[model samples]
Target: MPDWKTTYAHFLDTAKTAYTANEQRGDLLVQGELALAKVTVDVASNDITNIEREEELTLYFQMKQLLNILRAIYNDQFDMQPEKEDALVAAVLYFVSPFDAIPDDAPLGLFDDAQVIDFVHEQLASDIDRFHHEM
Candidate 1:
């Protein structure tokens, strides 16, 4: 198996490149739809009782919110610059990807997802905050 950390790092770098290019060449909306669908299914299939720690719960919620924001962007409910849109799409792709730094079934696996979301959120904080205000 490939090193998960290396894969994660490579994806991040790809996201950065996509963001800087400010072009939407790939099927970002399609990817976003698939990612959101998986997230919705995961949420519906799993019970919240397994979450024991407050921090873990917080991370879960944060990822959910990030996903929602990405969905809105994908659905054209919110408009953004090409760069921002590309960046957000890249982040969502990372979250939906299976080859995470930690497997999703592993203990605290979703933490890696949260970290990726946090990184993206930090990068696009201003735009996201503005969108929230507009909504």
Candidate 2:
């Protein structure tokens, strides 16, 4: 298998491009909702322990924040532009996706998900802060 770092970099680049290009698509909200649902299920199913075992408490908190951001967006509480919405949705999709830089079943598989969540949080920092403040 390829080095995880390299694979993760590639996934990030590809995801950014795809999400940015499709930012104006009509079905972006639907896609985001579906991805959020999957992530929520995973969260409810004790998947969070993976991160806890990995000792990435910061990432664990970021994941919860990311989920809240998505939930706000889905609930129409956040008035984001189409492009921003698309980017946010793409990030969620990346986190929920099983076939990522490292397969989710692999050892420490959630490391990639945590990385994605961290990246997304950084990218959407202002929006996240605003959402939290407004809530």
In model 1, residue pairs whose N, Cα or C atoms come closer than 3 Å (at least 3 residues apart or on different chains), thus clashing, are none
lDDT of model number 2: 0.62
- What TM-score, to 2 decimals, does candidate 1 have? 0.60
Q: Show how many residue pairs clash in every candidate, following the order shown.
A: 0, 0
Off by over 4 Å in 2: 1-54
Question: Would you list the clashing residue pairs of candidate 2?
Answer: none
- Residues 2-54, candidate 1, lDDT per residue (tens digit)? 45446556775676675443234236545555655655555555454444344
Worst 10 residues of 1 by lDDT: 19-28
Cα displacement (angstroms), candidate 2, residue 72, comes to: 1.5
What are the runs in model 1 whose C-alpha is more than 4 Å off?
1-9, 12-52
lDDT of 2 by residue, 1-135 (tens): 655455556655654566544333224445544654644565557656765544455655676676666666656676776656655665566655677777777777666767767766787889888988999
